[model samples]
Target: DAQAAICMVRGHAAEWNISADKIGFLGFSAGGGVAIASTMSATQMERPNFLCTNFGPSLMPVTVPADAPPLLIMTSADHPNVAAGLVALFMEWKKAGANAEMHIYGDGTGPYELMPETGETTTESWSRQMLQWLKSKRFI
Candidate 1:
């Protein structure tokens, strides 16, 4: 079902005048699995130029392609149940020789807050940080 997003992106990438090469996917929580599935899927166009998971589980036994796009994993120390998963994912990507970066926010309190405004709490500032990450990837 999540791959539908990828399919939709591929279906409309050109019509929308967006460069497919600049395409990327960002997902939160369970949506993170979708983003991973999209990137790991066989269809090339569905594989975004970048894959980002915000406070989501880190995938395992995934065969990252040689051309795998940069991967960004964001998590919070407050969520002990999921914190280690992100690190596992980072290591998995590195083991597979994929470009990866991770940002661990918060100080052992609070939850993952998506789409935080520019001047909110540390959890809220995640969205803003994502923008900077995009720029660093030269996608902006």
Candidate 2:
């Protein structure tokens, strides 16, 4: 899924007059995990035996720029696994000198779900906050 997404994003860069080297990925929940895994795993030289043989096409080289855009993640503190995974991913990005930030909200009113109503406060305009972060990073 990550490879496909990256490929598709890269494939469209030319039409937008944007360089693929400048593209960055943002994902939520399960998609977040996949994005982290994909960015790292795409650099491997050997194919894993666990993957199906029928998988088509190797991706473009994983060239995480020295100035790669920031990664922002929001997870629930009540969900330890989600928090842990995000922290670990953050550590990896930090070690690679890639910018990343994560927020784990305590006492979230919802679990693993995004609220649609105006009264929702768990995620509390997380999408808006993400947009702000992206704007701060010059990604938008």
* Index of the highest-TM-score prediction: 1
lDDT by residue for model 2 over 1-140, one digit each (tens)? 66666677677879878766556665555555455556555532211111100011112223344443466766666666656656665565577787777666665434334555555555445666766876776666
C-alpha TM-score for every candidate? 0.81, 0.63
- For each candidate, the alpha-carbon lDDT, in order, equals 0.75, 0.53
TM-score of 2: 0.63
lDDT of 1 by residue, 1-140 (tens): 55667668778889999876787888887778777766787477566778889878644446667677899888887776667777887887888888999988765444434424334665557777888999998988
Question: RMSD for each model, in Å, please?
Answer: 3.4, 9.1
**Pairs of colliding residues, candidate 2:** none
Model 1 earns a TM-score of 0.81
